[model samples]
Target: MAGRPTIYDVAERAGVSKSLVSLVLNRSPSVSEASRLAVEEAIAALGYRPSRAAANLAARSTRLVGVLIDDYTNLWFVDLVRGLRTTLGEHGYRVTVADMATAPPTENPVEGFLSMRVEGVVVAMDVPAALSDPAAPPVVIAGTRRAAPPDADSVTNDDAVGARLAAEHLLSLGHRRLGHLTASGGAAVVRRASFVEAVERSGATVVTIEHDGPTDEQAGFDGAIALLETHPETTAIFAANDLMALGALGAARQLRRRVPEDLSIMGYDNTPLARTRLVDLTTIDDNSFAVGIEAGRLLLDRMNDADARTGAGAGATSDGHARATHRTLEPDLILRGTTGPAPAAAP
Candidate 1:
């Protein structure tokens, strides 16, 4: 078997000392441009891949970030993770993701992240208070600002504004009696509240159905059935998330209600599914990718500062409670085929 090439091999090929090769590979700014180029040339020629583990050891940085998500089936979560991966990859950091399927009850996710010795963590779910430990590494919440721990930083969409946008769209279409399907938890609750507020502000009435289940197709469908049964006068429905919105569409079909003609529907997240010709759901674009990017940048900054503090023996401090830093990304209203002016008022 052939032995793996090491820094020594690169040094020999580039006619430089092993220390010089190490310095160049580590991106030491002190190395001359010529030396850096020569080392790179040799590395490319040898088809060598630098050992990230070894590099991390030498630099005292794991360069690993942990991401905890509530569910993986949702396309919105998938897109957010993709955004985080892209941004973190650009900064030379890898992500370790954990999906706590259907709302984790314990702190195992936090424990798992801590066990990995990740430089930082991005909690993409509404983690319980018990799950948040001050002793753990820096943590940031993504998606909903409502679940942000007192001591944790967060990035969220302007859900209130987004909800209002959806409400306004429906109202503009002459929707009067409205129904909202909401997921359980802080984010969903806030969005539902905003929707109700918008309806009231616009001189309309809103009937809300809270679903305490995963924000998936099934939950949406079930919620829709109940909502329609209870509020037969509802002319439009707004789902807290896109997945549920799709479910609601399915429920409407089962009840023989034609979309836009019999009812108008709006969903949030504006996921890929919403764009499909079959669904064509009018939704609120949360700009999830931008949220992921911002979260990644925040995590990196926290890691770098923590690294610097530990190196200087200054001890790292938590930013979770240093003045509620909430970042609300703007959301846009996407009009699609699912929503239209309310059908001519029944005779």
Candidate 2:
């Protein structure tokens, strides 16, 4: 019927056995680099698209989806996962999650998921090098990443917009000098940069203490302490996340600065901690749950498209998924007890 080019044809063309091709597709470390390059070249030449059924060497669907997150301790992902299950559960698909923080230092998270035979993958963290493989599954990235695959769908919040909104909120409170609590990498870089721009654009002064490590509560505490110590005139503080905001709160208490009186504090990601009666932090709602819902929807759309193309050759492309599309949701500021009018004077 001249339906599609199968792995057998690639094996014949590459002058290797079908099992060797499978090993190459799986990115087994046992294969020599030379053989890997040869197999990749053969696949490219023949436009052989590898799917879950093809990679597993079976034609049946797995109905399992892989999810990789940056950190497990950060409860922000809870809403994201719930939103994903809300849509995925109805379709009979289940998710298996892997946390990058807990993964072995030498292991590649993407390789593990591919080996697990997950039909698709959703990444809420950095894009892995292994994801560029031609045999990789359809993928959707669920949050703001600095770089995403050219073929991966992205459903994320606009951190830059949210950061600017924070600037506006603090500026309206008559804060002439401000501080940003941030980390050296991840989405914080973008948020901090945009925040500084917005604050400076409003003719206000902004200083920041950026941590060289993860943006956890410790980083937030340390950063806030440093920022305040150096820039006492800074009347307001904006943290990259709620945990950091909590840390900032601790810094305020330690330094004897009163919240919304001596220092106005704000945070990002309206997580559960932000909603707590004790925390009651003014924060940005990036809508992590909504992002998850859209991510699930995009992944299902990709899967449907991939399934529809089962009988067709991918025409010389390494990636099997369709062209990537990005969806960004607006960010909203949620006012709470932590942030108020800038101090009558910086304490």
Clashing pairs in 1: 151-320, 151-321, 152-320
Number of colliding residue pairs in model 2: 0
Least well predicted 10-residue stretch by lDDT in candidate 1: 311-320
> Each candidate: what lDDT?
0.79, 0.82
Best by TM-score: 2
Error of 2 at 14 (Å): 38
Report the lDDT tens digits of candidate 2 across residue range 247-329. 99999999999998889999998998899999999999989999989899888767655553442235533454456889999
TM-score of each: 0.79, 0.80
Task: Please report the TM-score between candidate 2 and the true structure.
Answer: 0.80
lDDT of 1 by residue, 1-347 (tens): 14556665676899986556655655655578999999999889887665654445447756688888777777787667788888888767789888877545774777777777777888877775544665677777887744467757678888889998999999999999999998776678878888999899889999888878777889899999999998888899999899999999999999999998998988999888998999999999999888888888777655554443332222223332255456789999999998988887778
